[model samples]
Target: MSSIVEIKLSADQTEGTKATVAQWLKRKGEHVTINEPIIELETDKVMMEVIAPVSGVLEDIFVREGEPAEENIILGTILETAMSNPSNEQKNDREIRAEETPKNVSNDLPRKNPAAGQPDPPSTFISPAVRRLRQQHQFDLSQITGTGKNNRITTRDVNAYLSGSMDQSAAQNATYDAAAISPTAAGSEIIPHSQMRKIIADHMQHSVQTAPHVTSIFDLDLSAIIKHRKSNKQAFAQQGAKLTFTAYFMAAAIQAIKHQPKINSQFHEHGLEVFKHVNLGFGTALGDEGLIVPVIQQCQNLNLIQIAQELTRLTDKARNNQLTQKEVQGGTFTLSNHGVSGSLVATPIIINQPQSAILGLGKMEKRVVVEEHNGQDMMVIKPMCYVSLTIDHRALDAYQTNDFLSHFKAVIENWQ
Candidate 1:
């Protein structure tokens, strides 16, 4: 008698909620040992490979590639059946016959099989973002070549291919006679949105429809902070860190929120609901598709080093399709660092639902300005950045919104 060992999903170290099965390494009837990598789970935080717990033959897979799975859910089963006993199993006759066939028997088989003796080579032909986009748009990718690392197709290539194909198809359709063209399009496609994308669209539409958004701008002088960062960035990198301006802004925003708690609040049916903890969500740009705001919880309590580490980890996970549902959830406030992309300023960023305001930081630039120092007016060069805070006017007045930005500016100017 053979016992079955189930392979279950596990959550990441952070407060992440769900993961998607990125890829599977082994097929049914393949023998695997304990701790062997069987599947890769793309959580909101990182891509984690779920290893086998006990040696057995992989029997059943409960999930497919690109499917969103909940945390702690069962992914597959490892049966205690021996590799030699291929005839006695639950698989259908076709599956059994296919399994019995030699690896080189497949019609699509190349002359030399690179995956014959070694473990399955990674399917690096398409990047994750591109694959997700293709799946979303129902675009067939038999003709596109990936330009990413290792010849992997990127999201941009897929998008461009889609656009070009659509234009060509539309032109070809117009040349056809009305009698030839069916009343209902024959080759049209109907693609469904992913769970993550649907949620994002719903929230974005709600925020735009419900909130009377207002944006207030302020300029900050970062001469002092720039010098401080220039001096400390080398030391920070020595500690295994990428010392971007985000860490500094996050620290400053925490101080500002502590001074004015009303900005870090939500609007409910009753009235304004203010939060005590400063849970800041960083609006990370994921390639060319869209943005995802992965939260950094308890910003007030964490030190600079800790903030940098978490930011690096979460952002990397977000880019690499590793974020969990929890990592993308529960944000009290949000920071949109549009400055990194060379934009000078942006106004009225759509609010993340349950949060009342979002802060936008524009590009940092050096400009000449006259200032009175010790009763003398002198032209001086200063690094300046524009900060725009978009608020829900239904819950907040303009005065309160402006005051919040003012406090934030003061924090940056007086950074230690």
Candidate 2:
């Protein structure tokens, strides 16, 4: 008698995610061991590997690469039938064929032609991020050497290739016309959505529908923090911490959250759910892949140096597509530093769902501002930036938004 073992996607992992089969590690006739990874599934939030549930031959594949796979769906099957009896299991044609000839009997695994005795060449494993990089750079995968596990190509290998040997002009001019695979109408191409892009669309739309959003903008003079950073950055560097403006921004945000605890809250049907911990999330861009936020949990207890160090590590991991699941969850508030990209000001940065508000920082520039010295008004050139707070009006109001920004501004401007 043959027993069938089915491969299924985890309900907990794929419940609300858009998952697609990234690739299959084993072919239909290959012998698979228990708990061996046989496939890779890609989603908007993470990349996951689905392992073999039983030690058996891969009997069937129900889902192919690039197909949408839902939670609890059977992806494939492993046949656990024994090769000892061939004539007795006449009802099963596939099972009878397994023992038709004498072969390697440990698992009696099926292969195309055992008589020829030529083993299949080992295949190179390309990770999702590495594949994306290759497509973006329009380079042949053969050009780069793999230095990863089992000779898999890592992101670092691709980066080294681009930096050391690849031509800048060639990379610049290399462009893939996604329109070739896209649907066209009247000379317009409808590009298909990637898993990440699809998730972003659904999430943003849900946030807009769920929250009544309101925004308030504040003008901030960053002179104090700038002077503080200039004097302390070298010392911070000695301690292996990079003192960027983001560290100061996060420090000030912590103070603001302390002042208005309601801002660090979530909207609920019964009432507002306020949180005691300040879990901070900052947006990091992943080229054209879209934005990912890596969070620092229990941030209220972290000092400025610790905050900067965590920021550095998380941002680096996020950009490299190496952030783990825990690193992206548990965000009580978010900070979108759009200023780093050269924007002067931005309005109503969308609130990350379940978080009451998000803060936006615009590009810092040297601007002339009026100041009072000895009770006399005078104009001075100072580094200035526009800070905006976007809140979910259902859980908060303009008063809280402005109050939070006011407290945040005070912290930044009056740094000791």
The sequence of per-residue lDDT tens digits that candidate 2 reaches over residues 81-101 is 554433322334334334321
| TM-score of candidate 2 on Cα atoms, chains taken together | 0.74
* Residue-by-residue lDDT tens digits, candidate 1, 304-383: 77788788888887776556556776789999999998999998455476688989999999988799999999999999
TM-score per candidate, in order? 0.60, 0.74
Q: What is the C-alpha lDDT of each candidate?
A: 0.70, 0.76
Candidate 2 steric clashes: 0
> Which model scores highest in TM-score?
2
